[model samples]
Target: MPYVPPPDLATLSLPEIAALVAARKLPPVEQWQPQAVSDSLMVIKADGRWFHDGGEIRRPAMVRTFASLLWRDQAGQHWLVTPFEKQAIAVEDAAFIATDVSEQDGALAFRLNTDEIVLAGPDNPLTARGDAETPALYLLVRHGVEARINRSTWLQLVELAGDDLCLTSQGARFSLVPSA
Candidate 1:
């Protein structure tokens, strides 16, 4: 069967987005305790480019598949996990990039570079880093992995934010401006 992308966020209500989020199945990387740990020689750049052994992984589907297997440990190390082994991967800034964003039923929805849709909520809250002068925003994708909000998406979020430069979704509030 051909791949069918999720419906546009603009047409989906908050409940529908939640249902979509719940219906998606991801690899059980967290449950795997692979004794074999090695380097995958994979790098995810801050700009969201994926490379392997110095060659760019240009296929979106391949990237998405790899991304589904990603797991970030408590020490902030990234790894591609499987039931048999775990391979480390370098992440320059964030594991994924938020390429687009939209608002629906008072909730914010984000589209990642891998074409995955994420909703900002208690389980996937938004965070800010750096100083107020150069703030960087991120959204928790899954299993401790985050997606850096790109410049264009950040601008769109800012436009949707209140005068206090804060955005709220699913009862969780985030300040876009970093603290001093």
Candidate 2:
């Protein structure tokens, strides 16, 4: 018999399929952007058990979820999860926007707008939406992503505080204090 694709496959595109398997289909961690349509990176196992759906692995997650796995978090905060290494980035977490990695002197270099970097602090304070105060856009790491920062991907990590916030994140790590 000829193999048939699932009915929903008709509504998807190759890029869409790739996004579900990896990349921007899911929202970044620590940011409260609107939810996406699909949030899954399928992993097909070697065993024949998971022929179509893949093998023993992380189940399909809803794209709208903040926890990366589930949309709702018990902590009452939205967070993003990475399947690559089972890592999670809090909704309040932030990173700078970086261009595609380019090779420099045989090394990979990352670049970002000085203004495009900011922390997603607890709430909107001095800056407005699309404002410089927004948490630095995070890098959507691939499931199998691993690199040594060949060219030292420069980043200015900013800490998120309340409406009146303080920032940090280069060589120092600090804890977040929640609002009561």
Candidate 3:
């Protein structure tokens, strides 16, 4: 489907817009089973920067709006999905990045590149990949969707690491490193 900006998008505050996005009931793309695929020129870089036609999408709001429509199918393909159409896009790594993090009420809250907030714990767990020297951390953002932990956020999380190599949030303990 062709993209349409909300009529009040320009007038709404960030929180209001976030609420509006949360309230949306997107079509079940996972169940759509589309047999046709059309490639788009958009690419989400490994560093969580988005580009279209080789130009960086510099506007944060525009990036967030596009991200709000992102979907990943069972085949592991990513798309910018709308109710009427789905456009395939390339993702070098995760679709979004956790650019900022904070702890509140015993939980770690992450602010994604798209301006979406996620609380990390059991439901939205944190995990690290790669070796200790170059570990890559990630956080679950939504249904089968994850955001790469940016360098600064990774450092912040590292600071919370316990002697046991575990991080506790919301009364849940997550191991920062896999057990030997």
Give the better candidate number (1 or 2) by lDDT: 1
What is the lDDT of every predicted structure here?
Answer: 0.92, 0.28, 0.75
Worst 10 residues of 3 by lDDT: 4-13
Model 1 C-alpha RMSD to native? 1.2
TM-score of each: 0.95, 0.17, 0.76
lDDT of 1 at 163: 98
Candidate 1 structure quality by residue, lDDT tens digits, 24-120 = 8998887899999999999999999999999999988899899999999899999999999999999999999998888987689998988799999
Residue 113, model 1: Cα distance from true site in angstroms: 0.5
lDDT of 2 by residue, 25-77 (tens): 44443344433434233321212111123333232222113223323245533
Q: Candidate 3: deviation at residue 119, Å?
A: 0.6
Check candidate 3 and list the clashing pairs: 1-85, 106-170
Highest lDDT: which candidate? 1
Q: Where does model 3 exceed 4 Å of error?
A: 1-36, 178-180
Off-target runs (Cα >4 Å) in candidate 2 are 1-76, 79-92, 95-100, 103-151, 155-180
